[model samples]
Target chain A: MKFTNFLQISILLLTLTFLNYFIVYQKCPAVTYDDKTVIHQLSKQNVNEKIFFITPTYSRPVQEAELTRLSHTLLLVSNLRWIIVEDSDQKTLLITQFLQRISKMKIFENFEYTHLNVETPKSFKTSRRDPNWLKPRGVWQRNEALRWLRENTTEKGIVYFGDDDNTYDLRLFEEMRNTKKVSVFPVGLVGGLMVEKPLIENGKVIGFNSIWKPKRKFPIDMSGFAINSQLIHDKHDAYFSPYVPRGYQETHLLTQLIHSINELEPKADSCTKILVWHTRTEMPKLKKI
Target chain B: MKFTNFLQISILLLTLTFLNYFIVYQKCPAVTYDDKTVIHQLSKQNVNEKIFFITPTYSRPVQEAELTRLSHTLLLVSNLRWIIVEDSDQKTLLITQFLQRISKMKIFENFEYTHLNVETPKSFKTSRRDPNWLKPRGVWQRNEALRWLRENTTEKGIVYFGDDDNTYDLRLFEEMRNTKKVSVFPVGLVGGLMVEKPLIENGKVIGFNSIWKPKRKFPIDMSGFAINSQLIHDKHDAYFSPYVPRGYQETHLLTQLIHSINELEPKADSCTKILVWHTRTEMPKLKKI
Candidate 1:
């Protein structure tokens, strides 16, 4: 090729490459539509890896509100399969309506989801007087999602345990999307500390910044780590057990999922910044109107 | 100019214009940065219009969680200036910490925010048995935000009243960004109805879908509308009044701001879809350890 012609073609190629990058990361802005029914959302059409977001929820005064807020945030993320396991024998109307309404929007037209219900046994439930942390909650609900994942698909994806009320930064999903083993990040306002994270040494998970249960093997919150779907398939016996002691659920799950703590991949700039928060919504006190 | 040269230049101009549209309507993906510091958000740099989002927040068990979630959503939008007014004698440490920490993040590098406070008088505050509708709420706090906006800027912008807890669709901001006058959209789950919105005729707001107090001038939820900042300048006395009867605060403000109901502009696909929701957080029941 002539030198001048090569230079001109090179410039065009570079422009195309940069613009392609711009489209994928900026979130493809939803296409404009006259009818709100066919609205679109900024999407990740160029990316291939998917996320399986598992959430356990129960009926509460703010259940609809919490789910609605959470659904909006989740919609911002692309390539996500929302697997909501309700803490009830059957899926409630509130959640069904939420999903159905959200699915009707054209912006979320391609959004994938699964709604399931498996009630937590009464014996495992926390009493009004007892502190909520006294028992390991969502054991059965999460297990049901796990059973679904194993039985339903052999797809390669990332599995994250998300809370209905917790705050999530969109960047958190981007960091977790590439998890090779178990990707770990910081959880803010957790365990009375501003942040709890896996201490990274040369990008290896050496220890944790947790003050509570410092002696536990994993020493992480449930929101702290995301596993490759391969881990779930590899460890059929891995499950969240209610029989474990308080604050041991994370350690128990991590023990079964990994060969060693070193297998953890540190994300969100090696846990220097918190991408998730362990936030709990207050139960509202109400009167029958 | 030669016809052949003019044709080549015209083709190039067309390509540039098309590329600009793609970059804009397609959200410009944030640039990559290795440091957790100096992170960037998908921004609307090409658009000139700005949204001044005024939010009223108070101390509650879920206050931090609510702010964190709302902040994340706001960070996704470009050209937005957040004005937060606290319902307290002075801004609480919790809110201070929330803003300061968020400001430190690079992903929110270009985010603009203002925080102020004004206490709700004892008479205006609702008691536990008052059913929350007995007295007007957020009147003083929202007024404080308005005063701040008027004092701080002479820029042409759209002003919106937002709550710390309500669910917001990201598209809601885009719909309101170009308001020439009052722009209204549907609010979901409000006033014991599934959706409440401005009834549109031709292109103007003719009436409303409200079941409660349909005769009111602007029978809409507080989360339903946006105004051009010029309207705030035009209506000096237009403010959310505490003296209004139950559910009349919206009507009271609209009465001052508009000369005729014909000035109202219908948005969010002419009020066909719910872009905002009146979702309240459940107060948490916590036991002292």
Candidate 2:
């Protein structure tokens, strides 16, 4: 080759070598469902991780729609089953119809509105002065859903009790898939109680930022948690209790399953970006019955 | 006088002097209310101060008996008006009749079930594929109660939103009687987030031990606070908003009222002792239902 041609070829080889090393060194950024392409790319990655989207649904249809949209959107990306328990008066035709749309999803539509009119029991003459009667109902409904899952699901999967009113991000499941035991993440629209997770150090969960009640067994809310199937299968009862205090629903269940926060997986990927937010839709002023 | 008689008199004088100095130097230990006599004795000491027993009731009649008993018991000690707001669906006739028996006590029965269910527009279909018809409902019920009190009540008294499930010691009200602004004390059964209150120094309110969302406008629970009516009257819209995030209920309202934690009065007298706790009663298991 001529001297000019040799110089050009040598420069091209150096550029090619630099590009190869750059590809090897740089890792891919954490996946966020910023758009459909990201989700499609995630789906094509080929991980057969089974995710059990254990959600607790009440009468709110708007929330149910949100969950269904989330599930259907997620089902396209991976092997998933939505173990949705309806905490309703009865399994309504409406909820049944909604669940039919989500493919590869199992609908557990059964609940009783046992704690109707909490005020009636607190009435001086009617209640005979019993203070325990004022507790909100439906804690057992969550337990019932949990029990049903343990008995029915033979496959290994992640379990999460997503309340009906909450706003969820689809990417949350992908992050939780690798959780060995129970994993915790930040929830947005939860006022300023942002980023509740185990204080992890060198891959070990140390403590929690549950400043409101740090002494409680489980300081996080139902939505802020994701437990491994093994944890659920290990426990005999594997259920929540009606006897637990109002906010103790999450705490009581966590105590039975995990030894310490060290057992919990902490995901702060979306911690800066609010993933799941505890947003309750407002009760509209009805124009007269 | 005889030498024996003079010695006895000298000993008696010394004993009286020691007792007088003890009473002046070390204030009497808070008279325990293990029984009714202690309550009666305290009632006589503070007879001139008008007692306002504000009980925030809910639908559970059985749970509210403790609150009703406290209200009734307070009536015996001094003039107390039970500002009982029922967190119910309708005006309960039984609660109305029960309040009638208490003399000089005003029972305000109001119903606002904001937490249990969110109200959506009828046209808001269950599924979003159809159309966007969902509208959030009754987000201002608690704010209405606060506005009603501000607009109506001219009397300067202590205001407390005592939830139905809570256990209250009658002496707690007396402790809060002289509160100029807002006073906070520890509550039992609320140790999950142990000892939430204003940080005080030299009998002045400073800040809070709020580990959660302390930065939120109001970061306190309903049961953990008691404010003078003037604060409510001054901060016109300082009531709660249902539309806000779940835990922001306390913080949101507090931010709108006070400029700083400096305005809050800390009652550390019972800080070591849990007084008004955020205890939610458990759901009872009914085999038949």
Candidate 3:
């Protein structure tokens, strides 16, 4: 009788073990979707060209806030690669970790990205007292992106210098995607004008409406233009200059890429609509006490 | 011998059960901190008054983006009660879910909030054809907040109308906290002027320097003023008027709350600093095609 009781207890224990495993399996199923699935979905269409938006970012109090805002806008576009170059001595753990988290999100999983860092030389760095307009920002970082495009990319794409703080319309990407050589559009709230636009007459680039300094051959902000990757690769030595006069970075780079003014294609309904803004966030005052 | 063997097996099974429980406990511990704990820490140090920041928010494409940015600012402040009144037919699941997630964050858990909704009547609502400036927005919602304040609280607090779209400096909160009767400060990028500030002379509110319609008794934007809660409570019937002319809501309400110009206390380094801007975000153009 004692042997019989032992057999019954063993059977009961075995039944309990199976029940527990079944419950756990029911509660915790495998995750069906992941980063690879998103990428597969995006690649299925097989688009010919993509937009490589190169944004040179740096760390500050509002760094994450600005990046978050910009990311929301960038994620809305399809067939785009985000290349974020950091102005740091090395690839910091913060940015690496940030990119890892962003890549895991549903919104960013499908988008291709390359996170790089190229530190600015001490002599080239601007001080707080210096006016922002005089600072030669994003010089080395932009060059790194250009170098990356030349080395790694053979596929058709367009390169755009998208600032972390600037506002962009989805329409701007469509214009840039259609560019054969270079494209220009109106940037609002910039250069002391309602819009620093490419003055187009009868579907040709004529002049500019930049009130701050209209005399420059290409008077525009960094957010005002885009260039085809083929053109960027063709002009091997073309890069933003660190020694240019105040507000001449756009003109200096454009002059190197384009042979004549006709190469500039005015977009956004012949440059009438303002699709981007050089909007800068005012630094917030933090009290230590 | 059989009975002895059964006892040994039973003891072994019991030991395994205890070990399993221990492993589960180790793997999944209870959350150490929560929203209630954060609120407790903030309220531990008792103060004479608190700040009641009333914000009237509506759903738009940029609603979450703007609120996230604003929450970053508002969360940094202590002793603040965020009254977010939504402009909708009913309290939305989206807003409620957003608030639940936000309130649980480490940064915002300390702040208290009330999420309320009151839809605008069809007649008073602005159409797409009407310019944003011409439409009298936030009238009924502001009054709903006022009613909530009167019905719910008896404690001494300061009330400030914080628009969701505007940029705010942390220093602005400190300035608003020091107001006795009513406080006014310079608002940046407002009324077609660099600053819409009060013209103070020898510590008196003489007049305003508003470029647009400076003739009004109190020519200021919604973000330019903060009033004592007692003054709002004392004048029980005072609320924003829906029938008021365009841009007259500020003047119409301030007229009821204050008896004389001397009652206005100028803060933020005697109103020289532009701590807040009436900054508006341009709508992004999305292609339906």
> Can you tell me which runs of candidate 2 are displaced by over 4 Å?
A1-36, A44-46, A60-77, A102-137, A270-273, B1-289
- lDDT assessment of candidate 3: 0.74
Q: Write the per-residue lDDT of candidate 2 for residues A136-199, one digit (tens) a residue.
A: 4446456665676677767676777765445455456677777678888876433225444556
* Best of the two (1, 3) by DockQ: 1
Better of 1 and 3 by lDDT: 1
- The Cα error of candidate 2 at residue B200, in Å, is 66
Put down candidate 3 lDDT per residue, A24-63, tens digits, no spaces.
4332221122223222233333335689999999876556
From the highest DockQ down, the ranking of the candidates is 1, 3, 2
Candidate 1 residue-wise lDDT, A1-289, digit = tens:
3555545654675576567656654443322222111012124333356889999998865566677677767765667789999999888887997786555432232457899999989988888789878887889999999999999979889999998988887678888888988989998777767677888888788998777778999988999999999989999889898899999988888899887898989999988977787776655433233
Query: Residue pairs in steric clash, candidate 3?
Result: none
TM-score: which candidate is best?
A: 1
* Residue B164 in model 1: lDDT: 88
Worst 10 residues of 1 chain B by lDDT: B33-42
What TM-score would candidate 1 get against the native?
A: 0.63
User: Model 1 clash pairs?
Assistant: A26-B29, A39-A107, A40-A107, A282-B283, A282-B284, A283-B284, B39-B106
State the fnat of candidate 2 relative to the true structure.
Answer: 0.00
Model 1 residue runs over 4 Å out of place are A1-46, A104-110, A127-130, B1-52, B56-68, B71-141, B148-159, B169-233, B240-289
- For model 3 chain A, where is the 10-residue window of minimal lDDT? A30-39
Structural similarity to truth (TM-score) of each candidate:
0.63, 0.39, 0.50
Q: Among these predicted structures, which one has the highest lDDT?
A: 1
